[model samples]
Target: MKKNPQQTIPFNWPHMTGKELFYIAEAHFNGRLAGDGPFTKRCHAWLEERTGCSKALLTHSCTAALEMAALLLDIQPGDEVIMPSYTFVSTANAFVLRGGVPVFVDIREDTLNLDERLIEAAITPRTRAIAPVHYAGVACEMDAIMAIAHRHELKVVEDAAQGVMSTYKGRALGSIGHFGAYSFHETKNVISGEGGALLVNDPASAARAEVIREKGTDRSRFFRGEVDKYTWQEVGSSFLPGELIAAFLWAQFEEADRVTRQRLVSWERYHALLEPFERNGVLRRPIVPEGCVHNGHMYYILLSKDFDRQHLLDEFKRNDISSVFHYVPLHSSPAGLRYGRTHGGALDVTDTQSAALVRLPLWVGLTHAQQDRVVEVVGSLTR
Candidate 1:
């Protein structure tokens, strides 16, 4: 008889403690199932403290937070926003939906983040903002990017969906930019099934962001007793998340440090195990820039070449592991080609990096034995 294949390990899955149920039960008992309940307030407080952000507003998703950011910025027709070509569609879509042009730029090979050196070259007269995504929880060259933004007087919105409580040069990733977006989707480090938050670092932008998140209404102010009644005030949409989700999210936030530490340990183990391959030129491990403290949101390997990456992914699947490749450079994507500009610069680095990279199975509960097996399989493939 043939031997059975190893049990399928997921690429990622939410790791929940029983604490989430208690919070949900409390939400049910409180009878404020809508947005802006006690749990929502608690979640906001927790995030604000962790990120050192002036104000944080919970949204239905990171996508919603990003959309609200674009709206708050007043992005208008033909305006251009510079971002990386190697990110999720939502990063560019948020701006594009508001009739803004997405100016795609290449990423740096080391961190796979929007190349700060290339950003200056991409800015045109129409460029209004720089949206830097902290890919895989690694910090971008934020200081350089911010300096460029300051010189050009451009707004900086950080797409920090994968960065939560992660620090760069001792400052939180989300708090460094004018506006920042975070995700609590099931796939992220923390989960509320589907929830996210917007970080408003500038005090000037916080009031307007609160208004925009509450569907153009002064509801947040009204709830705070700033006004007797709430009414619509600006162009906005329903971006606030419900109380139950916030309650579930709060449970995770309460254990944020522990959870992050656990994930970091696993991340370090992988890095240690993979260093030999990296040194041998068979693979490249993630590079966390100096002065950056990441939350270990993801772990990926860049193979020596594209063909090796594909072969490795195929073998991982055959071995009952779920390894996967990431984003196709947006410049070459069908929708991006239609609505975005490529800055007319060479995207060789972006294309090559995307083709050669593969994300291994990583989640909060992934066991050491499972990780060892994954490493073994990858090592065999490369050898």
Candidate 2:
């Protein structure tokens, strides 16, 4: 009997910076495995220094971070928040959990981010905030979005889950909005298995943001000797991640630049090799506008009308290569239709992109041969 071939390629493989376990041991030996310990503080400092946010609070997950943002904004019943529909359920669910409505707008054709131009039209008297998801680590037109928010006197929460180590016009993605969230999930360029951070950019919300992460208490101030004793302050949750997760993340943070560079090498290789496919109109490639530096968080292509998106995904799976389709436009989902309402007009761009986008295997340390194999399988399927 012959053994079956293993799945040679994966959609994502978490990268280790060679110091994760050592730091984990250090964290354990340091006698604190809980949240807001030494390792956790280090992670917070790292984020604040890097992104220049007023405060960076580590969360158990990006979802939790978004929930914190929703709380910080005080989103109330009947309030509406404008955002793109082509995003993860968390983007809408966070606001919905607060009894706030999500106004789903269409995305841009090229970058697939929320159309900044359409954001204004979605605003109404009930609008409380604008949540712009930085899809694929490529930013939304934040300058325009910020201006609109200012004009409407609304808050801005950036869903920058894929925007870690990414920037827009010389500023960090998460640091631009009043609040921002980042995912350090195993699938992201950075990894702590399942971790995230909420960046409090607006100074006015800084103190309350801390209270919210500490389960509606002022424990952070107590720990820092800012107050004699802490008590219930506001609506909040237990959003802090454990010290071990931060320990693992600290090791990766030490090598973020190198890790990002390696991913870019793979991303560029895929873009170059797939050029012939793009030229032949076999597919459409990702669009990176000028001045917006993405973190190579993903490498995806849009299948042309001639190609079947599902067929390509199936072919990759059969060939021991892993590929995947991205989000299913939230507006079309059952929960979306019930809890959220579509704004601006038709969701043509969101609908088409959702059906066509297929993300290729992109991970740090992916060998050239493995990448070529992925390309070969895609080409074979397209042909």
Candidate 3:
């Protein structure tokens, strides 16, 4: 067998703006390899300026940020946090680590986000927060969700891990909630290898967020001359990434807009090329509601009930194209079963959508030729 002439396309490629090495070198020369150095401050400023967050504390990973949110909210044993079962493990694990019960909710068939309508019915006296994950960077119905939280006085944590440059009705995704988290993993629109940020929207939580990221100390305050000295003040952990990661991130931040634009170009091309398949009843394309601006974080398609999704994926493999499935509903996973319970009797929609959806290769710098190969392979397989 001979290798195909068509170039190999990966699911994701971390984009760079040509300044990463320069900044990393600068950080090393500045002699601050630890967290909260000059580069870290610049990254913090970028996040605050971009998202309008009152304060943004960079963390080692999105999981750490979510865990910090759980801690900041004072989630205690037996307390309940309502969230969709379709989300990642970290979404539930963060709360579960604090001994909080994850009351799982079903996701909307359209956006695959937590259904806002079902939230009120699922709330109980023990419910403390509502963690709404912005699936695929398209926001949940935040207006309705926010109203429900206001009525019940529950905290809202926006898991905007995939939504750095996305918005809903002119408001940034993470800025709408009390606490929001973003990821800069290699797979995300932004890349810091493995990094995340915790956005504190409430002004009151800004100081505490800083302390939490610095291992339960007021070191940040002391650095700012707000305190005479630093000491461990609360139960916390080392969540901040070293300055090297921040230095690399600063480069990405500089070109964040351009990176998002490039990804959007690829996303639109996929949507356009595949519309005929959608019209022919071969597949269904992603939907972006009006006023909701997504970051083109991913491009996925859904197959009809009669279609064998695995068969299509196998076809792509045979054609020398790479495609992959999305998440396995967390509620059905072992940890989810042990630490959580579902709001509805059966999460039928979640299970069905999970089975049908397949994510196509998408990333910045995906050439037209490569995209054409993907579109051609998909068209032939579906037709």
The CA lDDT of each predicted structure is 0.90, 0.92, 0.91
* Best candidate, lDDT: 2
Q: For every model in order, what is the number of clashing pairs?
A: 0, 0, 0
Judging by TM-score, tell me the better candidate of 1 and 3. 3
Kindly list the per-residue Cα lDDT of model 3 for residues 15-124, writing each as its tens digit.
Answer: 78899999999989989899999988999999989889999899999999999999999999999999999888899999999999999888889899998989999999
Candidate 1, residue 172: Cα displacement in angstroms equals: 0.8
Winner on TM-score between 1 and 2 is: 2
| Model 2: per-residue Cα lDDT over 7-64, one tens digit each | 3787888788899999999988889999999888888999999999999999999999
Error of 2 at 221 (Å): 1.2
TM-score of 2: 0.97
The Cα error of candidate 2 at residue 46, in Å, is 1.0
Model 1, residue 145: distance off in Å is 0.9
What TM-score would each prediction reach against the true structure? 0.97, 0.97, 0.97
**Ten consecutive residues with minimal summed lDDT in candidate 1?**
1-10
Q: Give the backbone clash total of model 3.
A: 0
Look at candidate 2 and tell me the lDDT of residue 363: 89
**Using alpha carbons, what is the TM-score of model 1?**
0.97
Q: Candidate 1 vs candidate 3: which has greater lDDT? A: 3
